[model samples]
Target chain A: MELNLKLNLDASTLKADFPLLGREVNGKPIVYLDSAATSQKPQSVLDAMDDYYRSINANVHRGAYYIADLATTAMEETRSKVQRFIGAASPREIILTKNATEAINLVAHSWGREYLSEGDVIVTTIMEHHANIVPWHILCADRGTRLRWLNLNVNGNLKLDDLDETLDGARLVVLSAMSNVLGAIPPIRQIADAAHEKGAVVVLDGAQFVPHLPTDVAELGADFLAFSGHKMCGPTGIGVLWGREDLLEAMPPFLGGGEMILDVTTEGFLPNDLPWKFEAGTPPIAEAIGLGAAVDYLADIGMPAIREHDRKLTAYALRTLPGRFGDKLNIHGPADTSERGGVLSFTFGDIHAHDISQVLDGEAVCVRAGHHCAKPLMDTLGVTATARASVYLYNDESDIDALADALERVGDFFG
Target chain B: MPALEDLYREIVLDHYRNPRNRGELPCPPAKRAKGFNPLCGDEVIVFVEVDEGGRISDVRIDGQGCSISQAAASMMSVSVKGKTLSEARELERAFKTMMVIEGGGSPSSPADLGDLAALQGVKKFPVRIKCATLCWNTLSEGLTTE
Candidate 1:
């Protein structure tokens, strides 16, 4: 079969931007296909972080020195960039957290505890990553709240037919815009509208969606959106939790220390204003700067182009793998590429995912194999684990060809 | 490229394809234990029947895992089925010593391990040592449990 490779951006020139891609694994060139786990940072992001440390390193907000002011500016600039990247209303709505996991936890602890109570139902999907699932589970267990799960259809997307009924008594609905395992992009706008009609606030986990697709917070109609910098070519320690300005203003601070408090008297303390109220202590200043640089880099390339690249790559994989491997490979997700991102999770023959991962490592093909931290989704799919191959802007047809070649080797070696 | 022959040795594949002592032992004096490797969802349930003389009269291994894990379990069952409990424990120690991360050379020579020595290649792949040792760990837990 002919390969219809529609690459929006030239990977050859962009390949040099990520230094790690030039390195070798084992004896062969590293075929890094695990961008869903974490993308390799560009030299620009690294240089920006290094520049921050070299020139403008200081404590944010509290310091009176020149460097401190510059540092604060850099940090806030990142917040604005993130705001613009996701199309949030204002910078005041974006709260910096350690990671996406921490961001979700912040929502669960601050918002869930404050607004939700006994018998208050919160709806989440079967395909949510552990970060989104566990926090609500803990909140429900603690506050006597009832948790409802939206099931997956045969296509691996959330079955929204029963969503309105499920959201009837639900006070909140937290859903991922995309599945990390199945790569299924759900109808976030429709889900959000339905939840709002039922008087429930919607929280979208944009960790998988924001990096691969164009995310407009207002357009999506979600009250809160959370994502990490690491998955989008920045450093690991910084993440953004963007909430509706009104919602963020109403909720209490998640963490408290030096910065989050307006005044800490002996008897009591007053909380700081929006964003800062949620961000306590010294934040990830350097990582935030790096994230801003990464955001700038993505903006230069354009999210539309990146989205197209991902869809075309996903289309290529979906069309090629099954035709080549036939029944030997079983891919999980929507059959159509338009319904999913670039992530492909599958099993080759009866070989377990761990084994496939190990064998692929022989070919320097770095794919993720495990539950993908979505155990409930794994249960629904009737598999314990699957090997996931995900693509980003830097990847092209050569990477996919390398992957297919390695998978063929895996098939033959195992046989 | 990584040397595939070292990892997927002929004997290892044989045990994986046609595992020995797989299934359940009837209850009465038999004891069963379940173990899970949450990393890759490898689950093994070991059933052991110990005789009055403290020898393992029969041992059955049942699990679903990758080739390495399943093969390791199969080899482990074959190695320790007829041996006394103490002897099984000694072999377990030796096997773990072989799978150790640092200087992972076999403690007991190849002659000492007999058929189980085929798994010595697992020591090279650090991530896979747990897969090789899962059954042995499960067996230890099974024997110790009342």
Candidate 2:
């Protein structure tokens, strides 16, 4: 796809919408580059959450009062918003959880527990976050199942040459849509198609993908999609698990409590319905409403525009970082901007990532420095940790320039 | 805001650039303990050979980490070598006290911390305190274990 200049993603104007962006750190303006970890919430999302707490503060589903109805409506409205945002078949298919990790865990506990057994095989990639990898590891350990890893090539692309062979006997395929560390966007649609042809269910970890790029569940060909609200300018406690309606109906309740059951006598209880059967306790009411506002904010700006902005910023970083530092910088992802997201994980000379991060903090340029919760991928990359600077819709060339400028300081300090 | 120089002192950087006693000892004679900071993937392996006279005969540290962690381990190795196990324990206590005290104050007693005193600046950077303490904790583990 070509970069469309018609998109209205002015980073300076959008930066004003997020209150946290206005703050200063260490006497300098905060240049946040850790959006892959969590995004700064916009004023609209904060207002939506504040409004819920201020006006419609009540327990959902149980209270019969006026505010209770408003609370329930506000929360459920988020489900519909997420459903529409991802183009899900229905809101019933969207199960709200604490975060993307819990969303993936729900699939492992509810669906994997029922379907998987001894001799079954699960296929996952080395590039997945621990959230996507560990749940399947638990299920495999529990059920005596085997896990097959799909390794990546030197350029960080998945080795899809033998994808059919890998998916031959796999019962389920779990992988990240975009690597949190490498920023490599795997060919999820092609992998999903291959998995389906082999009669395997595809579980997509969209935590990193959903926050940056335009996403459509059907287009991705995933049986289930999991993403977090916190990474997308929403509240921390809310996440989404979008599954096929029939698949969710067939799975058992993940957590059992008051709201998940219809009739709870002395005997075993019947699960409630599609989404509620999974959401056990009183959900994150204000957080869900905040996520709804976040969805509205992104929709208003348009995902395409946000994506184009990310592309431009990423392309600039890809060029500028290497152009300035030459062989001193080693960026660990696909070199092409088209094949990657805005995440820039790199090692500058022999300086350790933490030391680099410490120096960057002195310049008020915030970046993540660690294994990024993907230890297995870290092993594959042959590095203990990397300094990561990820761009978002509110980031522009100036942010990238600041990152490059700060990196020069790293060279001066460590050289 | 703590300056970067506060966290990465000249002595700390010196030790980082040229770490001392940075190799593993044979396990049959030396007790080895591993310390890892999972958040940053920093790993430190400490080998301590406690003599029958209760003195730390030799100490070696082998690992990879940021300057703070590596330098701390390097300083820790030099500080405890040839000292009695109890004296080493006292140094650990004094160093930890320095790390934990508010305003990065000196220890209550006049404990001879030597090069380890440079790590008191790490207290200013709260997030990096654990990095300075990782090797000491590992050495403690190594000395205590059979």
Candidate 3:
């Protein structure tokens, strides 16, 4: 594979760090283009968890023993690492949950239920994964709050012309910073500012954005940010929910259990501090440590370089795929790479995405073929499903070339 | 890893490309059932018009999905049309039984399946068994309502 010398980041070299990327599938080297689903873990991240279990295997925050204290310190260090990773004010503002889904649910159940009332408006977008949308749906149903949508334009960008009107009387505005399907990077800062102007809290779904781009909660103007660890080369079963200090302090506890309570009483219980109030049970100790290592690994490479790589690779795909397939292929999302990330979603003729994916799999190329968990966006685009090929730091031009080469066979096989 | 050829048999592709009895039948005379594979967003709507003699006088398949799902529905429409309700049920049970068997079970009697035997290749790809069975499930639901 010839490396593109013009690229800022050496993806070929980066691929070596991820052990899974070195393996083969179907008798050929794997061309993994489904990073948006979940990123491949680096050896460092795997080793971090392995080391924790080997050396510091103990329960966190409860045991009085030296190993337990060490475990608790390690977990707290990861919390501080995450706090700095997203530029949160303090470690207290960062709450750990099962995944991004649980993070959003915590906000919906804790903050939403306490602040919102009947007839209150909660604004969201069509491009949201089911994680960000379903919680609000349940919240609205429970509280009798109205859910308003911010629709997308022809280019898959949010139509903000009616922003003030939509944000009118809205108590909260929830949306994704980067779309999982189209890789469209919406202007979150602009929307967040507008929501703040209307006194509506902005909840940014950073599952796609945090992994691929440089993120600062303050710069993005998000009041609460939610993202998963697995999507960013960290292990699964761990996610982050960063909220404003005051907001988290004011909200009621989400799950009432062991760690969340400061003192239990026969009558009532006192909730713990800012973050511990949200994290109910024994936390994901090693997983959080692994995520900290992932953060360190990404920081060593630098997010700016990663962002640049994503832009250049996405541009190459945006150009090469259509340039090769022509009218037969229809790439959905923004035509401008500046407005997009590394996610490439498209449809080819009448061929179902499943068939396209199956054909691609023959050559050891893995691509996601489904609605991409954005059914409202699928409805808006008039497609039941799309074949999505999302690039990550490990993917390069050769991978894209392999994808195109395999896609050509799809036309041959199905034509 | 089964070859794509095993899943996309020539007969399956033939049915997918040129689907038989495609479209909807009038509701007054025909019963309708819709099936959805929420995982992939594949939908199948099966409509059947049963005669007074308990025979499926007409059947039509309407929906969009992968070649496997669309082909399965198309083949099902052809196989059940003009057949007695009891005969269609027997075919559904036999087809489902074949799907569950590992490595595409060789039916005790291949003569019983006819072209449907080609779908036995589907069992090789476990995730896709749902795709092949979606139409039959919808048809079964429709028959139960009748």
When candidate 3 is compared with the true two-chain complex, its DockQ is 0.82
Query: Superposing all C-alpha atoms, what RMSD in Å does each candidate have to the true structure?
Result: 3.4, 2.2, 3.0
* lDDT tens digits, residue span A1-415, model 3: 1122232679999999999998899889999999999999999999999999999999888999999999999889889888887888999999998889899999999899999999999999989999999999999899999899999988888888898999999999999999998899998899999999999999999999999888888899989999999999999999999999999999999998889999998999999987899888889899999998998888778788889999999999988989998989999989888888999999998899999999999899999999998999999999999999999999999999999999988987797
lDDT assessment of candidate 1 = 0.89
lDDT of 2 by residue, B1-146 (tens): 88787787789999999999999999969999999987667899999998899899999999998888999999999999999988998888899889984335578774488888888889888888889989989999998888
Every model's DockQ? 0.73, 0.83, 0.82
- Write the candidate numbers in order of decreasing TM-score: 2, 3, 1
Q: Which number leads on TM-score? A: 2
lDDT of 1 by residue, A1-415 (tens): 1222333677778889999999998979999999999999999999999999999889899889899999999999998888888888899999999888999999999999999989999999999999999999899899999889999888878898887788898899999988999999998889999999999999989899999887888899999999999999999999989999989999988888978988899999999998899989889899999999999888778788889988988898888888888988899999887889999999888889998998889999999999999999999998889999999999998898899999988877676
The alpha-carbon lDDT assigned to residue A390 of candidate 1 equals: 96
TM-score of chain A of 1: 0.97
Q: What is candidate 1's fraction of native contacts?
A: 0.92
Give the lowest summed-lDDT range of ten residues in model 3 chain A.
A1-10
lDDT by residue for model 2 (A1-415), tens:
1223357679999999999999999999999999999999999999999999999999999889999999999999999989888889899999999999999999999999999999899999999899998898899889998999999988887889889899999999999999999999998999999999999999999999998888889999999999999999999999999999999999989888979998888978989987899999889989999999999888888888888889888999888889999998999989888889999999999899999998999999999999999999989989999999998988888899999899988877788
Give lDDT tens digits, candidate 1, residues B6-94.
88899999999999999998866888888888777888889989999999989999879888888999999999988999999888888
Superposition TM-score, candidate 3 onto the true structure: 0.97
